[model samples]
Target chain A: MRKNRSPKPPEPCLLTECMQVIAGAWAPNVIWSLRAGPRRFNELKTDIPPVSSKVLSARLSELEERGVLVRHVRPTSPPSVEYELTALGEELIPALEAIVEVGHKLKQLRGYEPASEAAE
Target chain B: MRKNRSPKPPEPCLLTECMQVIAGAWAPNVIWSLRAGPRRFNELKTDIPPVSSKVLSARLSELEERGVLVRHVRPTSPPSVEYELTALGEELIPALEAIVEVGHKLKQLRGYEPASEAAE
Candidate 1:
């Protein structure tokens, strides 16, 4: 018996289309950071250490244009801007979670140590 | 009340770790092709049109090195070469399936036409 997922193969175009959504430096990281809740600009940068403000700003704009996320100008005294995932953006979390699960296993298989729990 | 997957955010390194596993030009395509079953060199090339032979060969070698897939030299009359996913590679299928699912929706959401059923 074959151990494949489906009897027919998946179309390559589908994968390419989806990869482009998450493609780019720290794009996934940006999305992942917002997985928990809406985050302000500084919060996002803090969650993803070592990401320069310029690149982070650029990625936020790109994601917003892609409709994966939305920017809200909060009515705070200083008018804080927060980013949150759109419905489509929320759907990508499971896919990313699955990838993280596999990547953890792959890292151990390849003899690389997994990083300690960081979200605590 | 947040509409997020977890109360705690996912570790960024985990996503990065997994992304690296599928990183590189056409690497996901290589893995996606092998998802259905093992494929010969020419079969793979045909599956993904416009991919240069040099790039495809490099991808296979890299995937092999990363423990994602294995290459077998079939002891046929001319010794055919074939590539297939390993256990770890197989684990990535669901993640990719998720991606393809989101991608299909993303294409439509972005007002782009989805390619007609090609695998039918």
Candidate 2:
């Protein structure tokens, strides 16, 4: 005979945890920059100019801890460290794209040029 | 003849602006809560219990200012006010769904039960 299963309790709030991972001035920018590809610490710093090295490092570490990013160290002549989005992190790109699209739409509605059109 | 147009400068980063909109402890939850339908202030408070009244009001006002939600004051005895997602805000639901999916996946990888599965 098949056994009946009891309903499970709701999992601890993952949405709030995900939001915490992305909440911060530098975390989003860092994640956005990495969407193209992995980058060294210096490269990330250069790509996101307004962020200081200190803040960037902190954000990177936080993201890594959250499993959104993975750190790699290359054993070359000099050891080089790089950071890239994990599979979980890649999953967030579509969401970010959607957010960007909506943001552009809002800007257009408010009489500002949409970002994509403004890039034309 | 069509005029030759120079490529326009990249519009001020919309991604960052969008990130700013969703980046907060309560903002994502508030946005997610409205996904089903509009909610009055008290309704929202009950939906997201951990948030205090003062913080919820502040977040709702901030979301309204950011154009993510619209506040409608009902013409009633007590003048009930309801908050609903704008078109732009509705656009964010898919993104939030994607985030939640990834969040669940990450939780599973970490040996925690996925939220949906746990709810079953």
DockQ for all candidate structures vs. native: 0.39, 0.26
How close to the true structure is residue A101 of candidate 1, measured as C-alpha lDDT?
80
lDDT of 2 by residue, B1-120 (tens): 222122221432787776676756688888888887777887777667799999998998878876788999999888889899987778777777766766776665656323222332
Candidate 1, A1-120: lDDT as tens digits: 223333445478989888877877789999998888888888888778878999999999878777789999989888989999987788788888888887777766665422223323
Shift in Å, residue A25, candidate 1: 1.6
TM-score of each prediction? 0.78, 0.74
Look at candidate 1 and give me any clashing residue pairs: none
lDDT of 2 at A38: 79
lDDT of 1 by residue, B8-117 (tens): 46478888888877888888888898888888888888778878999999999878877788899989888889899988789888889888888777766666422223
In model 2, which residue pairs have backbone atoms overlapping below 3 Å?
none
Model 2 error, position A73 (Å): 3.5
Winner by lDDT: 1
Candidate 2 Cα errors over 4 Å, as ranges = A1-14, A75-79, A112-120, B1-12, B75-78, B112-120
What's the number of clashes in each of the models?
0, 0
